[model samples]
Target: MASAPVIISAHLSIPDAELVERFVRASGAGGQNVNKVSTAVELRFDVAGSPSLPEPLRSRLLARRDRRMTGEGVLVIDAQRFRTQDRNRDDARERLAAFIQESLSVPKPRVATKPSYGAKLRRLDEKKGRAQIKRGRTTRNWE
Candidate 1:
C-alpha cells in the first residue's frame, strides 16, 4: 500500500492505487510546446471501488450530476490550463482532493415550516399594491 500522492484532509486520504493519471497533449495555443509535449493530465478516480470513501459518501458523489463523472462511477478531471506537466498534475490532484473533501461533508436536511401570518399578510399587501399599479397604468393620461 503506497502512500497517496494527494492528501484531502488531516483525517481522510485517498490511496495512490485508486488514482490513475494519464498525460496527453494539451489543446490550444502553445507554439511548438503544445505540438510536442504532453502537458495535459487526465486524473481518474474510481469512486465506487475506492475503499477510502464511506458507502454514503460514495453514493452521494456518484449521484451528483457531473458530466466529468462516468456511468461506471469514475470521476475524470482534466488539467491543461498550465503549460508544464508538473503544474497540470498538481492542479488535477488538488481538484480531486477538493472534490472528494467537498463530497465528504453532508448537507443539513431542510426543515419544512408554514409561512408566518405576518409574512402572508405582507405578500397579500404586495399583490394588492401591484394590482393598484396595473389599474393606474390602464387609466393613464395620453397627452
Candidate 2:
C-alpha cells in the first residue's frame, strides 16, 4: 500500500494485505494487563497460501527452519517487548521486513581453486620434517 512496500533487497517484497495482522497482549507477564488487553503483536503470514508471491520464493520461504514458521507454512512473528500495542505491531512488521529482505539477498557464487605451488611445497616440506624427526628417534647402530 505504501509505495509498494519498501523493497529492502532484490528478492523481497511485502504486499499490503499481508501486513494487516494486529498485535494482542501476549500470554504471561503483566498479570492484569495480560488478561485485559491484547498488546502482543502476532503477525501471521501464510507463505504457502499467499497468491502474490512467486513459486520459487514461496518454496524458499517454506524451506526455512525459522521457529515462527508453522508446518503449514504460516509465519507467526511475535513482538511483545514494547508495552503499547502499536509499537509491538510496528516491531513485528519491521522483523517481517528484515526476514523478507534477508531471504531475497543473492548469495555469492563459489569459485573452485587449486592449491598454489608454494602451498604444495610447504606441505611436502612439513611432511619431510615429520619423517626426519621420526628417523632421529630410532636407535642408531655404530659399527
Candidate 3:
C-alpha cells in the first residue's frame, strides 16, 4: 500500500499515516451553511523540518516555485472543491501525497551526444538537393 506523507530530516517524506491539516469555515462561498460547517481544509506541510528527506532534497523542495508554499517554508494546500468537508479534506491529502511523490522522484541526467554520421550526411544531402532545385528555377540569363 502507498504510504502517506511524512516529515523527516528537514524534508517531507511519504508516510503511512495521513499528514493532512484541516481548518473550519473561513472566506468564500457556502452561504448560511458556511457559518455552520467547517468544510475547508488547510493542508500544512513543513518542508524544512522533516527527517525522512535529506538536506539537498529539503532545500530543493523549499526552493520550488509553488504558490502553495509560504514564506516560512510551510506549504499550505487548500481544498474546497467538494461541498462536504470530509471530501475536501481527502482531496487535500491526495494532493499532498502527489506532491511528495513528485518531489521524491529523481530526474534522469542528460547525457551529451554528437550527431550521428548518417544524420549529418542526410542533412548535407538535403541542403544540396535544395540548392539544385533553386538553381533549376532561375532563368538562363547566360544563354
What lDDT would each prediction earn against the true structure? 0.90, 0.77, 0.74
Question: Against the correct fold, how does model 3 do in TM-score?
Answer: 0.63
As a whole number from 0 to 100, the lDDT of residue 6 in candidate 3 is: 43
Ranking of all candidate structures by their lDDT, best first = 1, 2, 3
Global lDDT of model 3? 0.74
Q: Poorest 10 consecutive residues of model 1 by lDDT?
A: 1-10
User: Model 1: residues >4 Å from true position, as ranges?
Assistant: 1-4, 140-143
Best model per TM-score = 1
Best by lDDT: 1
After superposition, the stretches of candidate 3 with alpha carbons farther than 4 Å from their true spots are 1-31, 34-36, 124-143
User: Candidate 2, residues 7-110: lDDT per residue as tens digits?
Assistant: 44565566767655765658767878878898988878888898767787777788888998998888888899877887887788788878866666456789
At residue 44, candidate 2 shows an lDDT of 85
- Candidate 3 pairs with clashing backbones: 4-15, 6-13, 8-50, 8-51, 8-52, 9-50, 9-51, 9-52, 10-50
Residue-pair clashes per candidate: 0, 7, 9
Native-referenced Cα lDDT, model 2? 0.77
Give the TM-score ranking, best first.
Answer: 1, 2, 3
